[model samples]
Target: MEDDPDWGEMVSRHIGPHQKLRLHQVASVPEWAATADLSRYDLIFIDDSKTSELREQTIRHVLARVAPETVVVIHDFEIPPYQNAVPADFERIAFSSFRPMTGVVWRGARWTMPITQLAERIDARKHMSPLRHSAWRRYLASGTGPAR
Candidate 1:
């Protein structure tokens, strides 16, 4: 999800896209979350919030709606109270991004083969290149599967 249309395009270019994917250029993600049927998506990427509090709220809203197998990728995951906001029952894995940091969170039996494979392919050391040298980038670019 993204609030700004231009940046949202850049984000879409960065992550590639899923046929089942849904993008919401919403004004208030929390408000949108309040009514959105978020359960249908297999993978979700959130670089939407503009502040720390909104970020936490966005995550909580997503967590409340998504299924256990849904892949929730959050940008700037290592930030202060943002990290604190994540509950103990969920599992999060950090990786590189344009922010120089990103993380994917999930609950339940999250060790699904695709999820585990994505984690292994991601470069923990560098941001993705639009040129497609990154395995993780290529993996998504190919539309091989959802991050789940």
Candidate 2:
């Protein structure tokens, strides 16, 4: 859920009628959760909340109810707090080459094949922004470095 209506509307306008999606601007993640069915979604992507803890909460919230095949991605995973947000039992696939860096996680191993195919299909290296920040440098130096 987006917090700003104007930005959300702009995004919706950019999305146009091509994508089968609806963007909602909710006051908080909890508000959106109140009416949405997590299990029915095949994929879930949340814009990073104002804080890392909130982002983690949102990530865990989806994992708790979504299907095993569902893939959830959130932003700013290159930061240590965001990386720590991932629970120990789950495996995270990090793409630290991107500007904000992305983290992909699911509750079980069912995510492997599809993510692997997607990684193959999407050439992240070509789209990679040059690394300039210390945070990203540290993330790349760590074991959870980008697949590319």
Superposition TM-score, candidate 2 onto the true structure:
0.70
User: Candidate 2: lDDT of 50?
Assistant: 72
Candidate 1 residues 1-148, lDDT tens each? Answer: 5667888787688768777665658787766765789877888877676677787888777877887778888878778666666678888776643554777778877455566666655544234453555655556666554232
**Candidate with maximal TM-score:** 2
The residue-by-residue lDDT of candidate 2 on 36-121, one tens digit each, is 68777777886746776777676666666666667778777777876776678777777654457777887677777767645443
TM-score (all chains, Cα) for each model = 0.69, 0.70
Candidate 1 positional error at 63, Å:
0.8
Clashes of 1: 0
Runs of candidate 1 with Cα error greater than 4 angstroms are 9-18, 96-99, 112-117, 123-148
Best by lDDT: 1
Backbone clashes (count) for model 2: 0
In model 1, where is the ten-residue run with the lowest total lDDT?
123-132
